[model samples]
Target: MAKLKSAVVFLIFLTSVLFQAQEREFWLIDTETQQKKIVKDSVSAVKFLDSLSKNHFIFTELKNVKKVGLRTEIYYDKGQNFNEAFVQLSDSLSSELKIEKQFYTKNLDSLKKEINKKYIDQGFAFSRIQSKYLGKQNGKQKVELTVVKDQKRLIDGFVIKGYEKVPSRFVKNIEKEFRGKKYDEKNLLAINRSLQNHTFVSLERPPQTLFTRDSTNIYLFLQKKKVNSFDGIVGFGNDKSEKFTFNGTLNLNFKNIFNGFESISLFWQRNPDRGQTFDLQTDIPYLFKSNVGVNMNLNIYRQDSTYANVKILPAVYYHLNNRQKIGLRGTFETSTVMDSLYIQGKDYSKKGIGIWYDYTEPTEIELFLYKTRIRAEADLLSTHYSKEEITAGQTRYFLLAERNFYLGGRHYLNIKGESALLNSENELSTNELLRFGGWNSMRGFNEESLFADFYYYGKAEYRYLVSNQAFFDTFLQYGELSSKALGLRPKLYSFGLGFNFFLPIGLMSFQISNGSEFGNEIRFSDTKIHWGILTRF
Candidate 1:
């Protein structure tokens, strides 16, 4: 078996070199004036010739992998010996433009027959020819011969059928992308690739084609597919304040499940103290083929805190494309502060329904570490019958910026920041006090410290891939929340950093933070040290 394989490979190599149209010339002949016209070897470049001679020139008895190369021969009848008359015309053609490789088949009549017959097998007319030279040594009597390969005409029109689910209109629009092209049999087998590229469409079958309109048109048959899926998430956190919490969620979605043009999703999340939520959503796409998707989610939440007590929300989201997204979210929320042993009822929560318009835009930047994508979100909250956020509500102006970076090798980093401008009329809710020493922020301090009017958080992490499906991650963070705005007030800053090794099946979250200011008696309210299985999915 090994010897057979070796023989076959050698045969193929010989054929490839033999077919190369090395030292060959080409010219256009004029039948009426018997004049030879040389032309630049544009399409017949070196690569083109190598591809043509690749399998036709060699003599071999062994059969191996089907030999194939680029198509090079395109002939036309001049009604005279034009090829012969124009033999020397190739020398006068443009010298600047050169052939990458001018390859031709030599001493292989069988290969010519094989190629001409191959064209016919593909539905184009085919034929083979014989040529001989007769003339005065150099400028002899020129004669051009036409080896009649199968003759075929180009296609003019096409028809598509068997399309379901994939809007016919959309398919028709895509078809326009390939209109003035021919039915290359080789390419015909590959043309169906476009259907696979349609993100919204699921292809169930390969395309089938047939000739139409006097071989000038072809009708293609197609079939569309349907699919569906789901996602789940869970998160957990704890701190030195002896506080712990768990959050879990489930999302179910169906695409092209029934109405073909639409999809639906149901979501629910449960959290202790942090609140719980349930949402239902649906969307329709390409109603206008603008690459736009419109969806709506009905949401409800229950939480008893200083900033937000309980909430019932209904939101609509629209994604125009990758760069921008706009959403109008409304919530009927009740805010309240949990009674504490020390603070009593210092925090407050009110019930109110508010509608907000949120917009987020992301831009990419090339950074020294790697490429980073920064996203900014702005929201116009407090619509409908409601007191102005600056006048009564806590936050009137909210702005948040987040950046994600791709670290070279296996390291990945992400940074985020959020700020709010509250109206003087609205007192800061105790429950809204910026918390520290938790899973996300300053991990060294207790998780329930909201003393600051404004706070900042910075974090960094390094990851190492341990296996095809597992990795080890370590992270550190620093955060501060001051009693004054922009952290100028009596600062309750927290500084702590920790690391954890996370795995795919589960994760280990760890942290440690210090809630104190510099130049002051640095006393550790506490050092938070803990680990758990939790990684946002």
Candidate 2:
């Protein structure tokens, strides 16, 4: 009797396992489209609902498989109406799938990210996905999804908040660009930055956007920061050649001179042993909505007390895009040496077509992970002599590249390189020499310490933020001078460490540096303190 009972129990357990292994029919129906999807089992039905969650169908529920005779039916519910600003559901569905067309994806996380990103980019700041399954309907599994689109806002127009002296043309120009457009945060930030960079105006506060019904408006509260501006700088240092040196520069700017996006700048500088200098320049932006502009400058300065240098530069440029620009530039320079030097004066003129590209990837507040700029130019140079009746023609090429990187935490880095080549039919003069040194170049060397017919310099700086507004930095500078006629000069190298304090009003730095000349002995020479101030009116 006991053996017979055990055999019957085993047979029943085997039948139950076989029933669980058999496939079941499951259905997922869209509440809006009434589209039906047939799944193989409860697991497959759950996965189908998971895919729907990508298209803002967050809340989904599956019903237990009901066995009616030999068949089982599974059901699900796609919850709510989450899409409001769309003309078709497929549009949002494609975005959720991360594709250009309506397609299916097996990646659950990717679908979720795409759906969330789409909602956030479309101004659905408080949107969420909620799902639930409420029983079966019509012998098919019924599932529902709920998408809560909290705020779907659009851009309407701009309103001037305060009665400030802002030009109507400026306001109109800004409005025409953003009116009736989507509320894109990136574009709005860019516009705000452009307005802040304006020379004659300052925003009392960042422009605020107001939303009403289906539209939004930007409010501009403005004040005249200044119509005229002035800035000055002073420095004192001793060079290896010269005993003591003092330098000072002053700039005076007049904005909106012609009332059509034009400005004039006057600059003056005094260097005790070198000479006094004056510069006048003006620039005008495009008026026809095309990215075309012109700039002109005239500079006259004395160098080394024995020679006076005058330069005039005029250029025209057209922006190709946000990162690229093409320009035509000319340089006319002349030198006069009546103060009794070995040679008289020289004149050089060059005209070139140049292209410039800049790219920046900001990773955090006032920080960037990648930033780079490339400038390359080709020019035809004409050289003239004052005392000697000699004229030379040369073709020159120049390239400059600068890059910066932020490598997490306090680590910041900057790298720069510049090179110039001159192919001449006649001998080149000292006036055409490429030079580097001093504060802007190799910090451990004197001003223009190294000069050559063709020269290249490379610089790298690594900074560690020691405090909220202070940086401890280390730098390495290298330069090479190559002259076919004069033979290759010795390479230059410099390394230094410094502390930089970025104050609220200006930047101050103190550094001690060691440098080598001509790959010879090493010494610490250029230990100095530098301060600079810049304020926007």
Question: How high is each candidate's TM-score?
Answer: 0.43, 0.62
The reply for model 1, stretches above 4 Å from the true place, is 1-308, 322-324, 337-376, 380-425, 432-459, 464-468, 478-537
Error of 1 at 451 (Å): 7.4
Model 2 CA deviation exceeding 4 Å by range: 1-133, 136-142, 146-242, 247-263, 266-277, 287-290, 320-325, 339-341, 344-376, 386-390, 466-468, 484-488, 502-505, 511-514, 525-531, 535-537
- lDDT, candidates in the order shown: 0.44, 0.61
Candidate number of the best TM-score: 2
User: In candidate 1, what residue range of length 10 has the lowest lDDT sum?
Assistant: 362-371
**RMSD, every candidate, angstroms:** 14.9, 13.3
Candidate 2 C-alpha lDDT tens digits along 1-537: 234234433433443466776654545555456677775654555445556666755565443334444344444456642331111134555466455542223343454456666676787745675434444443333333345777776667788766454555566667766676656676578667656534455578988977666667888876554455565656566655646676655778887755555678998865434656689998775545556768898988666556667778787876553345577778787776655553523554444333333333323322222366677877776766655667677777778887777788878888988887877877765655655555556666654555567878898999888776677888898887776555657787878787766555544556656566674876433444344443334
